[model samples]
Target chain A: MKAYDLSIPLGPMHPAFKEPLRVKLKTEGEVVVGAEVDLGYVHRGIEKIMRRRPWQKAVFLAERVCGICSNSHNLTFIETLEKISDVEIPERAKYLRLLAQELNRLHSHILANLALFLAIEHETLAMMLLNVRERVLDCQELLCGNRVILSYNVVGGVRFDTTPSILKEILAVIDEIEPKLRRYAEMFEHGPLLRMRTEGIGYMSKREAELAPAVGPIARGSGVRFDWRMKHPDYVDILDFKPVWREEGDARARYMVRFDEIFECIKMIRYLCENMPKGEIRRRAEVKSGEAVHTQEAPRGDLTYFVRTDSFGRIEDITIRTPTIPNLGAFVKYMLRNSPTIADAVVIYASIDPCIACLER
Target chain B: MAFPKLVKIGLRQLIQGPVTNLFPKTPPVPVPREFRGKPRYDREKCIGCGACVKVCPSGAVELIEDPTIENPKKRKKVEFYMGLCIFCYFCMEACPVDAISYGDEWLLSSYDKFDSKLIVRDLPEREQS
Candidate 1:
């Protein structure tokens, strides 16, 4: 028997990633033996930026943290500030915030699924998913005024309110999207090639997942039934929110978890829109000296934000713990196991859906 | 069965045609009513209060004094650098006289960062109050 060790560096710039992240893999023949991750290529010192900006303007800065889950950052930041000031957001504003967050989740999950398909060379499925995701973006643009960086959440409440026609448009978009998502789910579940590539590839036990203490779909995919949305006070009465989980604990299970969650989000959005309360959309609040820790379920996982404010309403200290940080441990562990092939390694890495911008920032 | 699923999806898409627009060749799609695009400044309505400058998050709005103009009323010029603008519409909200409004034109791309087209100069003398 002969063995050859080859070190290959994948990304910092590669087709597999939308952002820059370097992963050095030590391979023997076609099997990866060791892995080392190199991040900080896309770090912009967002926490430092947040501390420098005025508390009022920092919401926009927070929104700029990650282009995909921009709303989650804003929501977490505002919720932190609101907690410090002890301001109760109006019922209507809560519903509106929930709506925006779920819409963001819809787009983010679809994009993640699109990346998974693309990683496995399913270009047609990737394009079709992108096409379907556009409807969610359109709905977001209609509701929040911007598709990507929705500066919707202000200090005390949401920036804008919706009318009946806008609500109708949103419901109509949801009506169109639900069936497409169902078909996609069917394909993911029944498609042989997809299953061949994804199934039983990146196996993580419930013990490993619990030890990593992973949050979001990654953890749930391994049978850890935990979700921040269900426990969140704002969403408690809005809908019957439940966490989706699968026991397979592979790349396919993770994929299925995200796919099913999209449907869950669709149902949540529909329920919120149907039962939306009519009231003032925003309230004036004063920020005082205090600190708060807030958490919300970002598309990737549970995102947490800690914020401190001075008496004059300036940010004293701000820290953001994005989901990618916790999931990185599980990713490294998965890569180093069983000497998986390069293709399996890529799929596993994509399965964790590493957001370098969020992690390094 | 898996092949049949792909075939069905392909046929459905083939019948429906492409979902993307022929943009640039065709005109761009219309933005929503509240979209914060290019900021339009009404020179006549500006009161030289500099409120927009105070509220701009990116320092995109600047009040440049025209040394050439001796008249105090016509001396203050508002220079809006679209390059620095994040399209947050904070300036529009801060303008007390309704001098700034969000225009629907979002295609502000340029080869040069400081393109002349990127700067909107609201000269006080151009339009009399």
Candidate 2:
């Protein structure tokens, strides 16, 4: 009997894959038969950290889970705390939270898709996509003083209020960003290099996509009309926007769906910015003894946060289930049969937009 | 036919200038006046209120009080450690005096681990213009 062995280590610190998941592929003659994802490098025991911190303080601390989806974690923490305490967030705050969360989605998906483009060797297209994404980053920095971690979400409401001046700056930025983004979209649609890399690559069938616990673009790209904003009308009621979907279950479809969603986010932000309610942005509430579960769709997928508060100020327990876990599962499944080479396997992995840091946290 | 075509492409490439930026040799790009970069601390205006230290998520800033300064009215020394900084700019935002502002210099790579630590010394009363 003869056996052939090959092990390709992806990253603890890699540019191609986000959040440092070690991809160990067992291949036989350039065809990957199996792949196992190992994660522990970026784990900071955030749940343990949350346990030590006070309930109110955990809102700020939890946002550190992932820089890209910081606002999502903040929303999750706030919603969980509110549920546990049996308090309703003010209508205005809810609107603002939804607005911030959607904008985060728009930016994160673009960044991830662009990173995939870069990995696939569509350098020019990647640059164009990233350049458009810079507008979103700039707007975030101007709004919250940071591009990724917009520590704007607080327990009762948001810390920062958008005044006319802030709105005007945001509008000016969106105005500058939209036309450039449109050009990129046109270029992406027509670019042969983009077509060559992504068109038929990483193709996951509809049946497989349905069985898998996919969320966000991963689910939507497969023609599955499942958006949290649709099922939960609070997001739509608060922000007033429709969900975007695409039918093709391929890499290019995911790219197109994300591009379309960017416009939807812009419209949502514009509406919320224009019709911001004149009221107290935050509600006055204190954490009490109870337990509650909060689930929200992060940029990647559904983010579940479990919280248990005690009589004292400190939170007793907190557990986070990131979207990347299920997304990684789908990637492993697809790559096992589809990708024949190490590069192919890597490309398939990148397409899912895995956030290892979020998983580890 | 192919040889002549290759020569023409090669000659065109030779005439076109290099794409690489002359980084060290040339003057740095002019940062816009309003552009925010690294945070620089002006110790004179700082009241040692510790607002920056409290708001820092990464615990990068520390308020070091000096007992040697006898006058109760005089402010104590507060040192800054930029090494552990997440560059969130919360310290500058929380500063009541607005003594700290963004600097355009972002070349913060240090050969020695301690060199990245930016410590501001308090100027004498005479030096305070």
Candidate 3:
């Protein structure tokens, strides 16, 4: 065995990644054979904090798991509380829930793709982030008055209502934004540098994808037809859309899958806008003492929340598993074959939109 | 590659305007009204509710109590530490008094950790009822 000291520390810095997860790569020559990740940097003891707070208040705490995936965490925690007491939210609330989730999916996936471009130092593509992200941010602000952390989802209902005016404004914003989005997607697909860098690189075979336990774009890229949206039909059954998947399992394939998912989300959002059911966005329900499991396919992958409530209105226990945990495994596998540069590792990691804070929680 | 096609790209760069603005050295480009940047805190409107303190996920806000005040509620103070602040703006959402507002001070940097932490007054005496 040839001995070589190849250790590179990625970051705990505020700029490198929003969340803190230090990537320590051991490379033999230019190939990374082994990788270890450290994630204690951003751990705020969210679970422990949740255990101390009331279950109702815990919804707000859980929603802070990550700014990009705020709605998903908000939904998961609320859904767990609803399940524990066997409370059913109103029909209209469910529709709004689906709409918010899909919008979040669109915003998160696009932002992730933009970040991947940023990591590879594609300034032209990276500059597009400001415009593309602004659309979703405007939509989020119009709807909930906040862009990054939308504190809309309450216990049994959402805080904001999709009034006629709000709906019209949302639709108008989407109309203005969609053309720019499509143009960027076209640019991404045909861009020479983008193609050269991402196409057939970081290839994860279907078997390898399944074996690695990655989900969302990582799994869908490998042709694994697994999506929590399909699995849990109750959440998205009424929404008229299908899960986006690709067989290539390369970085470009993952990027394309994300782009296609945005279109699907828009379709679902439009459908919800046109045919929004008439009912209260929230329902009155009692928070009971019991243990319950909550699961939702967040933008990245299956975000699971386990909650146990005490007789008092406070939460007894809370646990979360973010998508980054599984998707990160794919990097060690793929980077082993490539002449891994620091840039390559950064690109591969950014491609998954790894949220280390959520993982540590 | 064709020579004309190659020359066209090269010549265009020579004749074309600069791709990026030279900051500080040249005049700075004006940002839009809605640009997202650093946050601002207002003391007058603040009710000393401490909602901002509780809701800050980053533990960036610290409430300093004046020991000599007759009414402790009226003497509450706050200091913001940008070092730990994530810029999530949860404090703005959680503020009942609407004391905290988002500002355009994004170019924040400091050599010392203590210098980076901003000390903000939570609520002045006149604001208290």
Candidate 4:
């Protein structure tokens, strides 16, 4: 083998990544032979700060871990807290939380596809994806009062209740966007440029995917259907979702998985909203000493939060293993290892939907 | 062949026109009434319970203790530093007396971030009990 032809550093501050992360690629002319990802640039010590805060306040810290998937973090933190206290929230609250999480999933999947299209230099598709995403954001704002950092989930239950009008507005927004979302899926599947650019690019094998332990769409795309939702108590009963997967194990496969999952999200959201239970939004939650863990499917993949609470209900220790950490490993080892071109490697990085802030938090 | 897939969307876009505001020419779409914008604290209504200060995630709300003052009422002070506010409205929710509220005014920019108009402070005589 000859020495590498060139090395390209993709970012600590680059357009490809909205956050600070660096991927060093060594290439032999056009083909990437090796890649080294350097993280920790956006580490804000959110976990350390979370440990110091009262257990009630740590969900906000978790919400700050990732801007795009704030609902996932916030929900996972409170679910872990509830687990520690053996708190069974009300029936209506469960459906409401499910609504928010699925809406968030829809929002995040659209963003991932948008980023992928952008990587392919398909600006029209990316802009259209963003336009479609605004509907999800509006629905979230209607449901939870804020678009991004929704402090919607409290310990005993959700903080806000959806009136009939708000639910109707959410349905209207969903109705308006569903056709557009379908169009995006078709465009990604059959669009000559998108399919040509993404199909067969950034291939990862099932065995490699397993070893990297990539969860969510990456694992599913690789033909190893490992999703936390199948086993998660919160979702297993509520969301009648089947895992969306593809056998290709390529960038297109990963994007397709995300695209298909949005339909499931839409169905689940509509079901929850139409059949929503009427009850109290929340009850005062009190806690005592215990340790508990929560694993949930964030938009990226499996996010785990493990916590230990003191006798007085103060959080003694908290460990958050965000999904992107493992997915980042999967990106470097499975997808980007001995890959084709440097450009393909970059698209592969986006294919994993890496949230560096979540990883570094 | 190069631009084949986007033809349908391109035609749709031609029909829909642009989705953004013209800034100076047209006012932007209004935020929903439920929108959580800038936070404001009512000095007259605050009982100095300090709930907002404790629950504020960023320490945007502070209890400016007047150590030199003799009166217990005068010594207890609550300050709203808008600069640190994350617009999460945790303070508004945490306020025991419902003194903290979200104002419609979202823009709080100034060369001096600490401008007097930007901050909500209690006068020493505020709510003299």
Candidate 5:
């Protein structure tokens, strides 16, 4: 008989993942001993498509890279081009950008935790989290026109400007979502079932996280005090909150970090709503031949965009590096090394917040 | 905190009715007024400069030239294949003469992709506007 008695393949399409990602697990009875991740199921050829289009049209193409964190991709791409062109946006536009991106992070973190709950077989928690996410989405929709795929960021500034009434409504949304998130966090913290399933399961030590070269919450959850947002000058000038991290390096630790992050996002949004500067939202970006690299802390992690344009401001070449490459790649290789049970593996995968569309793009 | 989270949620569901709205059975939750849904066209304002034709990222907006007409001025026309429209409203934004506006129409489902009703076409050029 084989030492590893059986191999079970889980999904290019699975309930635990919203996108297609296949993971093959080699198991000895109920415990998984080894695993292999498979990609390339959802190659949309978006990068190749972006190169054919100029920056103006390509911003929309960038937004399509990930439905969940569309604004991050759009913002990063625009900033890369703008840096080369030396198009400085107004202060109000920077504040508006902060509001939009934080709301984006808020909803995305909630959704990631919702996935974790669903994978752990807690349907009730998942459904409730979906409602909380909808409120955050409404706030996003109020500021920007669309819910999921928003081309809110244009060449010089944002497309939509916020009214006083709009800021008031966003504040109201945060007020409602706060209590619900707090209550749920308390439930998850004290709930024996969640703790039993998540605590000390699928551990990613600080060393493993550094070795994986993980960024954003995945690295934060594993005790690394690294965040790309800290390096972004605009973020430092507008928002004062520090990045949230947890030391446990397990499924529970990862989700706890998300809960804290939701609160931090709420704080930043509130500050922006109160102190939002009033000014013109946009300016014309002149087309220039130059190259620049820009990185934005996306909902999943650090997303980098490198852009080189011709003398006419047409995109000569553009490259995007999404965090899931290092983050999820490490999860499959290091974190999933010795899974105790089938259910634990799913929860662990869900906890890392794998954005496959962004990864494969 | 709710000691048993499930019971607390179940009780709330018992009181607050269903979480989801009755969509398809009823109207969708009203979107904001600035919604760029159901795009409309005004032929009088269209100069046929092809700004929209160039700016449309989806390539949904087309400048359909009337080969049947010999006059170059009257030959050029605009038609919106709404099926291909991503509702990004880039065409409306790119219009130099303000030829397009938001109609606030959400549902665009039809059995035929190129149904005549689905297409927002330019009216014939007023002999000498």
Candidate 6:
């Protein structure tokens, strides 16, 4: 019997997708033959909004681009402003900013892993992961007043300073969560069901990953040893940071990379808390007419922000390139590979950890 | 090995009951000291400077002049719409008189989006010296 090709559109509103992202797939029986993606569902014209707001207000607006990595958006925007104005941030502010960014990374990785587990029908594991993640959110709330939309970073520095008690609380939280994170890593490594679902699924070669130019965990999973944290020492010099990589270039590899990264981030946060510098949290800076670009390794991947200011210190243009955009290219490629079944497509897509809000914004 | 691992987790969970809260019946989870929730407007201290109106990212704050009085120094009333507040506390930071403060009122749900409880209005006559 000959198999007929079937066309299926997965999500703009499906249980598999965390956000509204539709993928057109052509399959023969259960194996996908072709795939195409549609973005811009969550686009709020964030760049246009930034251009209209004053330089000071734009930082808050930038944070609205993505809730999970809101601090990175604000930090990158402020860094761009600092570059245009040539403002020198205090050492204490730098450490605080790094702490917030790392904490965000920890939570985001856990959330991504949770989503993958949920997609694979591992509800118990997902619940356990989420329970651990709540502690991270609580820590964030204790530090910055809000759980998700931190609005922590200001133009020249951070919005608030940390106390000894706050640092102690943070250390306590880290100490508690680190062991649970290890258990999770162990489960991912040893669990037969998880291995069956993730291992050898959605395979991408190092060459393809580089060609697609995947960033963050997706790139590192494919054995591409590229991370902004290692390259940009000026921003992340405090931690003895190293890029985590896996040669498998599959869904399991990405899962392992993120799992290991959570531990790395925990170490970085501990370091920041230990050697936190004492100084002013913020310094007022004047913005002048200029253009500047800033890049940071967001939990998903490398996020770049380009800002251009006019002669009157008003924003002329603001553009953001989120990590999910390039990873989407890799997603399309992953779907078309190995003749993935419908189930495999969902797992592979979740593995990319696509943030459609960030992509559309 | 699998039996031991399963038994270990099961015994641990048995030792430590549930991690969730019994809220509404019990008290709500306590917010952190710096938790930004509902903005508490101090009518006595507010100078009607309209700074909060200007700095609010969500346009949650508004200043209205009292048209009933024909005096040159007509006192202005400040209105805060909780529905639009992002809880960033930008209004608190911008208030010169320190009239705006955030309280730990996390449960602010209502069926009506335009509920009167959502809007905190400072009458002109209530303005303190």
Model 3 misplaced stretches (Cα beyond 4 Å): A1-5, A12-19, A339-342, B1-129
Q: Can you tell me which runs of candidate 1 are displaced by over 4 Å?
A: A1-4, A335-339, B1-18, B66-77, B122-129
DockQ versus reference, model 5: 0.54
Candidate 1 TM-score, true structure as reference: 0.93
TM-score for each model: 0.93, 0.79, 0.75, 0.91, 0.93, 0.93
RMSD list, candidates in order: 3.1, 5.6, 6.3, 3.6, 3.2, 3.0
List of clashing residue pairs for candidate 6:
none
Pairs clashing in candidate 5?
Answer: none
Candidate with maximal lDDT? 1
> What docking tier does model 2 reach?
incorrect
List the global CA lDDT of all models.
0.86, 0.74, 0.75, 0.83, 0.84, 0.85
State the lDDT of candidate 1 residue by residue for A305-351, as single tens digits. 99988998888899999999889878877534643688788888888
Give the Cα error of residue A290 in candidate 1, in Å. Answer: 1.6
lDDT of 2 by residue, B35-65 (tens): 3455677776778898887777667778876
Native-contact fraction for each model?
0.48, 0.00, 0.00, 0.48, 0.39, 0.78
Tell me the TM-score of chain B in each candidate: 0.80, 0.70, 0.76, 0.66, 0.69, 0.79
Error of 6 at B119 (Å): 2.0
lDDT of 2 at A97: 75
lDDT of 3 at A23: 78
* Deviating ranges (above 4 Å) for candidate 5: A1-3, B1-12, B65-75, B122-129
Chain A TM-score of each model, in the order shown?
0.97, 0.93, 0.94, 0.97, 0.97, 0.97
Ranking by lDDT: 1, 6, 5, 4, 3, 2
Residue A93 in candidate 4, Cα distance off native in Å: 0.9
Q: Interface root mean square deviation of every model, in Å?
A: 1.3, 4.8, 4.9, 1.3, 1.3, 0.9
For A1-361, candidate 2 gives per-residue lDDT tens digits of 3244877677766677655668887778787777778878888998998895676557667889988888888888887887777777677777777767767877897888888887787777787677777778766766655667777776677766666676677778778888878877887767787787677667777677777767778888878787777756576566554677788787778778888888888788887778777788877778888888877878888899998888885788889999988877887776346775777776777788878789889
Models sorted by TM-score, best on top? 6, 5, 1, 4, 2, 3
